[model samples]
Target: MTNSISITKIRQLMTMISLILLTLSITSIAVRGFNWGLDFTGGVVADIQTKPDVTQVLLKSHLDSALSQDVQVTAAGNEGNWQLRFNDTDLDLREALNRALLPIDSNFQVTNSSVIGPQVGLEMVEQGGLAILACFVLTLLYLSYRFEWRLALGSIAALVYDILIVLGLFAVTHIEFNLTVLAALLAVMGYSLNDSIIISDRIREVFRAKPDGETDSLLDKSIVSTLSRTLVTSGTTLVTVSALWLLGGSALEGFAIALCVGILSGTWSSISIGTLLPRCVGLEPNHYKPEETESLQSMP
Candidate 1:
């Protein structure tokens, strides 16, 4: 057997961790709910350019006091630009904001402001859900045709696992779930699938080459052989995403964070759920047996 870590032996541990995370995520979502942004729950998004002296804290306090409600204020590109999000659609709120900012800088300008209606938010939610569902179904079909039903099922399960973990983390952390975050989730799914496919193909190749080899040893060796590639790919991606998270400004913050978490979870699922589930469901040498052998054996 290869010197690679025995992922199969720790299957139970992984399952337990997944269950615990799922339970915590569900509970957090049920209790605290998501810190939905203007894109989801429907509200106003404004981009403003304030005086260089204006600070995030001062802006937030002014907006809260003027609007009589909490608002999300984050630094946008450059220094004076700021992004504001809140659940208020009244036109008067705009006037109120302008008046409130007069003390800081009479010249401050509201570059843009837009409202998202509740109905529109609902439609966006539906569309996002459909997109994820479509990805899952299509992935299953492709895998089934390319490999087998067992492998397809396993790959889908891993995908779900990756998504759930990411969702759970967001819920627990109270991160704003917005359209950008949804895009991140989809991107994560694609990356996770790529890893799963690589591992699956390697396993299939090993089966075809060494039909008489022990399944456990073959699985271990296959995973070990591909470990370098997995590490390199995932490592490089992580470095880029991490940099974005740290310095990409608030607009891309959620997107970057989502990618970072998803990459980690996806990598784990590719190794654990991707390989083990198919094995548990009865993947065998015969699944890859040469067509010529089956034809000759049947003719006798």
Candidate 2:
């Protein structure tokens, strides 16, 4: 029955959340300095298809020694095919690995060889970085148009916090920054926005229901009331993403893990960022509603 919300509480929560995000980002940078994967740093990758009778261990060993350079070999397609990779190709591990294979079976032709350059990868990084910024800008615009500008501003700030926190984790954990991982970040952005929007919608309902309402208290109650729904939705999403991470192989692992980070962050942001933000900024419910217009009397 308490329609009043406390603005002070909302500001406190926002301040704390902001600080937590900054700490997470700084700590992450200090720890690993962002692990740039071979794709970004420049390296060699070869897809060598061989006979079905080939064994992974035998192939790995053969390539490692014949090339005189360290290499990793794994089944490429079926049990018959193999993919070989070496870092910083100046040593020619590819030739060495191929030579090693000749002793076993020379027919293992160099089906594919791609020497990824740092410059090429750097461009990719730039493009990817731009795309992320674009998503945030668009999300901000859309939210502002649909709701109030304050909500829009708060939602974006929270999203940035979520992203920074995830990056910090990547930096701290030293996760490889590959194309797959970049894709994961984009996915998280979309997911986090969706979650925050849901929480915002609920808080709006509480606002219009009470006139002269305090936003902080209303937001808090709205958060509590929607807590069950939030958990249920997030829990289900986590379960699906968990399965992909656990069973989808390396190809999907990064994507799934990114979701795990993002979804968790999204849940937190919904309450801490989305809910508290609009209230903290004094985005009254009446601000969004169109004013009623009276019909003009016809010459009374």
Clashing residue pairs in all predictions, respectively, total 0, 4
Q: lDDT tens string, model 2, 218-294?
A: 66676778779889999999999999999876556666877798889878776776666666677775563433311
- lDDT per residue for candidate 1 within 209-274, as digits (tens), equals 887777767877788889899999999999999999999867788899899989988888888778
Which residue pairs overlap in candidate 1's backbone? Answer: none
Q: Model 1 misses residue 69 by how many Å?
A: 3.0
lDDT accuracy of residue 116 in candidate 2: 81
Residue pairs with colliding backbones in model 2 are 5-214, 5-217, 6-217, 67-96
Error of 2 at 161 (Å): 1.3
- TM-score for each of the candidates: 0.91, 0.83
> For each candidate, C-alpha RMSD in Å?
2.3, 4.2
- The C-alpha stretches of model 1 lying farther than 4 A from their native spots are 1-7, 74-81
Scored by lDDT, model 2 comes in at 0.74
